[model samples]
Target: MYDRPYPGNLYIHEILNGHDVRAYNYFRMPAQVFTGLRDLLADRGVLRDTRFM
Candidate 1:
C-alpha cells in the first residue's frame, strides 16, 4: 500500500489504497479502536514485530 496518508480526517478508499483497513476487519476486539492502533503501529511500520506493545 502507498505510504501516503489521507489528506483530511475522513479516511476512504483513497487512504488505504483498496486495502480493507477498516476497524471491522480485525479479528478480536473493537475493530475501529484496535484498527486505529494497528494502523498507527503496524500499517505505518512504526514498530518492529519484536517490539512490545
Candidate 2:
C-alpha cells in the first residue's frame, strides 16, 4: 500500500487553523495563545524550525 498522504505538520496545521475549540481541545490552550508562545520561544532562540521539524 502507498503511504498516507498527509504528513504530521499538515495535520497540525489543520488543527491550528480549523477552530478555536479544536486547538483548545488538543493543546488545552487557544490557538492564539499557542501561536504566541511559539513565537516567543522562537524570538528567544529557544525554538528553531528545521527541515525535519
User: 20 in model 1: Cα distance from truth in Å?
Assistant: 17
Using alpha carbons, what is the TM-score of model 1? 0.26
Summed backbone clashes in each candidate are 1, 0
Per-residue CA lDDT of model 2 for 26-49, tens digit only, reads: 999999999999999999999999
**Highest lDDT scorer:** 2
User: How do the predictions measure up, each by TM-score?
Assistant: 0.26, 0.83
The candidate scoring highest on TM-score is: 2
Candidate 1 residue-wise lDDT at 37: 80
Residue ranges of candidate 1 with Cα displaced over 4 Å: 1-29, 47-53
RMSD of 2: 3.6
- For residues 1-53, what per-residue lDDT tens digits would candidate 1 score against the true structure? 33556433234333334344543353344545555786789867885554223
TM-score of candidate 2 against the unseen true structure: 0.83
What is the lDDT for 14 in model 2?
A: 84
RMSD in Å for all candidates: 9.7, 3.6
lDDT to native, each model: 0.49, 0.87
